[model samples]
Target: MLLTDDIIESSCRHNMDFDLKKTLEALLLSTAEPILLKDVVKVFARYHQELSEAQEAIKGEEDEDDIAIEIPSLVTQAQIREALEQLTEEAQAQNRAYRVVEGPNGYQMVTAPQFAEFVRLLRGAPRPMKLSPAALETLSIVAYRQPVTRAEMEAIRGVSVDSALHKLIELELVIVTGRAELPGRPIQYGTTDKFLEFTGIKELDELPASDVLSNHQIDEWMRRSEEEPEEISDEDVGLSKEPKPDELALDEKFVEVDWQRENVESDAAPEPESNENTPL
Candidate 1:
């Protein structure tokens, strides 16, 4: 029979079995929000006096135990389980939802996975955003340094880039798939397919090698930078448009310096003291 207000109210008012009344009340209560069998059982024990007598009869003991009766004996633990099962089946039949599953280490009431399509229809789904540049950079670093925290990235980049990281989330370039095992359990960021597209690379291996700038190349760049004056125009700067194969030959002949050794020597050099005692 269809569940209408008059039908439910009439059943409640006339010749109502305590079990049926409790079930009706449970259905009404659950209408306010998602309710579980355990919750309904608690209410039946508290409010239904006839259920208490029925339970005492089922117990088959005449002791004045003074125990607060909850579910009637007719609705034994096994019966309660069965009733809950029936309620769940009925809910399914009516295109309603009922289920229990583990969530974050505890059980929760959730719509059956099959009814997910219905819930999705009622509530519009969330769409992912595009990743931004800084998000991409953060994602790249995190990808290379799996399980790295935000602190590590900030230390390397020498800047606090919280905002950029948030933008990356908006773009879906970076996602917090898991947490680091550190004390605070900080979130770890990682790249998505969009990162590869943005970089125009098939994989992380396709990225340009850091070895492109050798010590000799660094020295050449420094020398060229120092000797070459700020440009005016090609004509005014005395720059030749003609190819200089000979310049390449000269460049090939130059011996490369060990920048590591030079770096130490440069650091060891003493600083010039202020000229406080200089002769007038």
Candidate 2:
């Protein structure tokens, strides 16, 4: 039967063996995206409320055949969590193609990784998205260091992020949140809901710890970036230093010696003739 409202209401009022886990399983399978825990609880709340209203309406002149079938109490969040856990276990036990996974946002039913190729084939998958390495790096910085400005991203990446940032914004993975309260009030960038969706994470906190940069280290970078920099020479960053007066003189002496030695070697026949005359 179709999952219509009246049908759901009827089920809520009439079902004797209502299984919470099974109800969630139905919900998970029905949704195209992850469902929030609070949303699931609210669905049940509304169901129970509607059932109570219907019960009250029928109580006035019910026929003898209408039995008082027990309606389940309002399901708690803990109950919902427990039910979801059971659903997860059940899916695993059955070696189902889909599994119930929970993330920061809520729970979702996703196809098991082992079935990815099958699903991909079923969907006639499109060409894989091509993100430039630079874009990925910029996206990572934004994901980990968000509420960050383009300047900060460039600082971390050691290059301009304009192109990469623009691409990410176009892809709906990143967005301009607000201006940073810095000297110029630079615009800050942040990851979007689509970013979490793309990454298969429910929220930002679910983002895995970065191996290249931890939060603390990023914080330090930001802190240092904020401070006024001291005067630095090219040598500070491994550039060649200008030769000092003494070093220049030393170099000139070596050049003079090398040049004289070259000239003397080239004129060896004349020197040998002078020495041969002395020997004679």
Candidate 3:
């Protein structure tokens, strides 16, 4: 039989002098994480030793059932599990949910993961800043690959990205610190402290909200995009109007004009070698 309140009250009033409620509350609140069975037993030993000393001072004997003595210490695994189940049932009866979650070496109350997104929608606070589609895509690229060169970021996004990057810089979400050592020394970009605060995360590792795409699916999508045929414009397909040649033709002398290209390859073969490479 477990020790009842009558037994505890009689013992404390007659022989024992300890404040059992204070003792129990102290032990329960001390645990930052879930208390294990072994640890519970060890804490029980210490409490029991103290109770025995107090009992001897008043000349009282130890009782058979340990609940009276045990209530002052950390709870055993079985006891905690039973209490949790009972709490869960009581919560369900009232149309509420209760959870015992382990976090950072402690147990804490938390809402179910499935309900998190729904809660977010219910709260519905507007974001601190609004971003254009291009700006959003540019920010994502910088986020995933930080300290990336401007050219590298452009390569991944398949765009010039200059205006978007400039906009982000103006918004103070992205920063350009220094130049890369690569040829021509392109500039490098990375997110700022403002970025983390705006995204509501303390660190970059917390960025992913969910896992949906598998690597195989991503690879297949990329391969299909590369293999797809290019679409021709309406003008190229002969659907739109074409201007009369008379209106589009260049002047005769302008057609003969030769313009110099800055980056033209000098090692290429000359057009006519027959005239000894066409005297300059």
Best by TM-score: 2
Clashing pairs in 1: 45-70, 55-73, 129-171, 130-171, 131-171
lDDT of 3 by residue, 212-234 (tens): 23334434655676785877777
Local error of candidate 3 at residue 212 (angstroms): 12
Model 3 residue 28 CA deviation in Å: 25
Better of 1 and 2 by TM-score: 2
RMSD after Cα superposition, model 2: 10.2
Better of 1 and 3 by lDDT: 3
- In model 3, which runs have C-alpha deviations exceeding 4 angstroms? 1-127, 209-280
Q: What TM-score, over all chains together, does every model reach?
A: 0.27, 0.68, 0.33
Candidate 2 stretches greater than 4 Å from native: 1-15, 62-66, 103-105, 210-212, 219-280
Worst window of 10 by summed lDDT in candidate 3: 98-107
> Candidate 1, residues 1-280: lDDT per residue as tens digits?
2333333344355333556534643564455344555655664554455544444553644553642334433334456656555654566677655553222222234566687777777788653245667665666666565455687677555677698877776766667778878899888777765566455454655656544233355446546756858857666768766444566655565567999999999999999998999989
Model 3 error, position 45 (Å): 30
RMSD score of candidate 3 (Å): 15.3
Ranking of all predicted structures according to lDDT, beginning with the best and ending with the worst: 2, 3, 1
